[model samples]
Target chain A: MEPKVKSAMQMKIQVRKKKTIVAKDRLFSFLFILPSILAIAIFVYGFIGWTGYVSLSNWNSQIPDFSFAGLKNYVSLFHDFRFQADLRNTAVFMILFIVLVLGMGLMIAVFLDQKIKFENLFRNIFFFPMALSFIVTGVVWQWILNPSTGVNLLMKKVGIEPMWYTSVKVIPGVEWGKIQVGIPIAVIAVVIAAVWQMTGFSVAMYLAGLRAIPDEVREAARMDGATEFQIFRKIIFPLLLPITISVIIIMAHISLKIFDLIYAMTGPGANFVTDVPGVYMFETTFRGNYYASGAAIAIIMLLSVAIFIVPYLLSNRKGES
Target chain B: MKKKWFAFLSFMLALSLLLVGCNSDRASKSGGNGTRLDIFSWWTGAGEEDGLKALIKLFKEKHPEVKVENAAVAGGAGTNAKAVLASRMQGNDPPATFQVHGGAELNDGWVAAGKMKPLNELYKEEGWNDKFPKELIDLVSKDGNIYSVPVNIHRGNVLWYNKRIFKDNGLKAPKTFAEFFKVADQLKAKGITPLALGDKEPWTATQLFEDVLLGTLGPDDYKKLWTKEVSFDDPKVKEAVKTFKKMLGYINKDHSSRNWQDASQLVGKGEAAMNIMGDWAKGYFVNDLKLKVNKDFGWVTTPGTQHSFMVITDTFGLPKGIKNEDDVMKFLSLLGSVEGQDTFNPLKGSIPARIDADPSKYDAYGRLTMKEFKKARITPSLAHGSAAPEGVVTKVNNAVNIFVTQQNEAQFIDALKTAASELK
Candidate 1:
């Protein structure tokens, strides 16, 4: 063979090998992710599909009866008093929990943003509750908020009698169809406990956001003769909106599926006031063996969760675009 | 080459995690063929736990070849334990035996699910049919097949009172509705809570309500109500609701915050006059809280129901798919035996389910209870699951919880009528 021809053959082989390397890299990444996608499809999506099917059936008895009853479980849920109470509780809890957590978190982050002494110590102290499980926080708060023995003891000294978590629905209940809708007084105590534990997460996020805001922007505003309040109101708060949305989405999801905390602290407080979907779903499934109703509840929770999370994902996609 | 190595590493890691998940499941299934006995119960409290340990020790001595695992879950009134059992059963890993309340809790919860192995053959062989009371036997049976062996019985309608408080106020144990109200009125005027009720669990209120039902409607009518021979909306049932509502008005203000034990404490401390709780409160009082029985506190059947015994029996059933059926049967036989019942019940602070339990082994309350169990017309309890199904109990609990706060008599009656449909 001619030397030029042999050299051309070797160069062609090397170029082909480089091209194959890129293809091989892409192939390997796909292979790695394929198992996860398949797993999620089978396990998560499969269970979800199964639950939806169950919800449309009359599987209330111990036996898993999957004969289609259609729209019945959902229709029953809409009229169901316990489910209505659960919805009312969840709405109130979500609003109260998010607002308080955000407010406390922002306040703490702003304080920490300042050149304060023992900043790390104070940060850790606030974040400490987040480190503990919701169950742990719930139990500790349960003892502390006990109407007779806990904070009420302190209140007793000041000639005040407070019911704490034991207090029934404070909001004068109005008939919402067959169900009575009201702000459960007991849920307020739960909100305070939930907020205390979760505020640290928001604090960390808000702190990062506050720190990420350039000092030059604030300085420029100051130089333009803007008051501190005006600078915060106009610049800092608006800049933190993205982070605020993230916090709201994350916290709302956590609040929706709240079971362990409520179960441990107070097992369905007076008239199911502290009752939420997670607890109701658990009890209906395990306690009553109402598989269909429980599935209906799970689907409702998933849909409600999507109401918050779907928009966030779409917004993230838009930001990237 | 390094990229290939990374790919291989990640692949192996994923495979290992998948293997790890599969392995634990296999480990549980593998034990099914082994000579292992796993006894599950929620008896993890002071006296209850000690009683369970003693029962295990006796079983150990009798069947030393069997490897025993005490799968007792510690929690309030077995609610958490039921959640654990549900998950375990769902995984198809049933224990050798697990504690169940005799009636609808076992039958409606597990038997209805086809999770329980019928124990009629065991009963025939062990002669438990003649050993246990027929009414009690009826509770453990569905369609003539005995499902479980009753270990001990806790009377739900027993009203415990502070002896000092009653004596201090010159009050006798109220035996009728009129007498109860008269005494309650006097106690109220003295600023003493007439009834110390801790309904934190809500079923505790249902317990009080069931007693009120028994008092309002006699034993036959009460039994008829559960069987659905009579409706829940019976005028007598209405009267029971009225009585229960009246009883609720006389209870402690902070009743919802405390459990049954805490209410017993209120009575023990002489702050409240009386508490209508199960006989287990006697265990909590004497064994845990360390108060003398019959001296610090005394008990009578919850008023107007002295002729009827409100029986709440703790039973153990053979769940399906357990390893060593023969070995498990030995445990069930022993559970029914006088020796097992006597050893377990004395420490448990409840009267043994077996009629032959030695009277000498029990306290004064147990002796009195044993006598009453034999003489009084036997009726099953609803809240603790001898009379009603879990579906019924769950609905009743939800309704009772709302009723405790709402105090709407019509709503409470309406709820009971709904729960009655669960039996059908």
Candidate 2:
């Protein structure tokens, strides 16, 4: 009976020691996170808060006086023809960019997985563009896409005599005539550049997803006399759903905040053709309309990303569950 | 475990103290230096760099104790520099001295906020009114107070042409719009593009529009149109637009995407006939590219204009919260002085702000511009000068760009009307 009581007392002492160790672990974890928290609070949160405040006031160039005109900036933004145009351009770019990047990415990944020659070389070739800065890629793309100086001249040398880059013609009877347009050309150039840069990233992710599938699953399908195409369509594609959704969400976020490529390729003048919400925000702030309207636009862009991402992430979580 | 926690806390406290010390040191260095002045500008390239260095050298020689640090933001039209400057100023960390054109755009926000110090006292002390050109003095002053120092007078109405091309065609410099068209026709007949135009930059198009307005419509009408006194639909304004559109026929087919320097090179290489750009193009010709002034190229104002020269000037403004007030005063005094203006302007490919400078020291074109200055043929360019406000200028630029590229006269008129109405 005394031995039994001593054993219980020993167990109680052990339990108390474990609790102290757990508390110590928790304290270390908190300490580890403190610096990151401070950094985010000071740099990220502070800038965001400052931008929000600036967006409430009309701060023009060289002038520092900003008056709180409350919602007047928003009213003006609604009426701003350029801002509306930019929204339309950004929407079109986002939709088209996502479709192209994902579609191309999956196809390339699948082709590489088929035991092609120079597999590593091909993968590296596709991924090399991703490593370049957007500014450098933009400049290269601009040189390639410039109608007068680039592809047009190359085509001329090849005896193709390309006329499409210079002039725009619509069906005469369709309430439109031949009107010269560069905006569409500019947008296409931006998309091509973006896809070139991002397809490698998508390919890498898709490859990982493909590799995660167990060999037994494929062998079992083969044993069932399922064709390769049938196996890929029915089994492999379905498993990639999560990865595909994640890629779409991430690419969408990237497309929304795309500024450097567009800015470098074409200056503010591109606002006529390829202005996105990001570029518009820049112009607005630079033009000294730095108050409610700028903030409103930023908020609008944030809400848009949230609207798309929240549902996607929720579904992803549910899929995991 | 307690000792570990105590050590971690102490380390964190030390780190925080270290950060605080570093930040305070930075703040003091940037904001508390009495002899140091930070000047931000968008000047780069060998020629411009040389010119700026010369000016800085002179400034330092005059004020031995002061140290001038140049924050050069190199981009054409200063769009990048403007963005950086806006962000910095918004963060309440403006540079000591910054470049701003002498116009409403330069004075827009800072002047309204009372963030710009009036240079009126400096102007009086330096006797700037007696030395500087009256037109330039008027250009830099707002509400009877000088806020910026006019550095160099840029003639924006100069029409530069390859002298060889003109001579080969047996055509003299056109003195009237009618004569200019005839010359254009002659060049076209000879299978040459009459105008070597670069319209990729909208400002280039705007410059063309301003030149046409000043040359065809005269200064009063141009000012009235720019200031929104007259609607764009007015028959005279429409006439000006029509004339400009007609001139567009003389440009190359690929003029839509060429750079201004490349366009100038077209003339330099004798590929195209002429280029109507600002006098700064002279720098590209005579200074950098080694084309002789009045020999390889010729510079003239657009024909039959009441005002022979449309002048714009580069100016600088001191931001509020300037660290060294005495240094700011010294800088302002130096900027307005005859010696400073003369030394800086010639290197900048612009005429001096002070009319009292010796013309013998200037280039042929500069001397000619100085002569125009003497004859009172100087008028402010609406494109670069102080005719319209900033928002209005941007709107007009967009409208003109659309007009040129879209070739939609009605849309152009509507856009202009909208822009004009916004001014009020």
TM-score of each: 0.94, 0.90
DockQ winner = 1
Q: Which stretches of candidate 1 lie over 4 Å from their true place?
A: A1-15, A179-182, B1-17, B20-33
Task: Report the Cα lDDT for residue B302, model 2.
Answer: 74
- How high is the lDDT of residue A289 in model 1? 76
Global lDDT scores for all candidate models? 0.87, 0.74
Task: Summarize candidate 2's per-residue lDDT along B350-412 as a digit string, tens digits.
Answer: 887777888887888889788787666556665653555555666676677667766777777
User: How many clashes (backbone atoms < 3 Å, residues ≥3 apart in a chain or on different chains) does model 1 have?
Assistant: 0
TM-score of chain A of 1: 0.93
TM-score, cand. 2 vs. native: 0.90
lDDT score for residue B174 of model 1: 91
Q: What are the root-mean-square deviations of the candidates from the true structure over C-alphas?
A: 2.7, 3.5
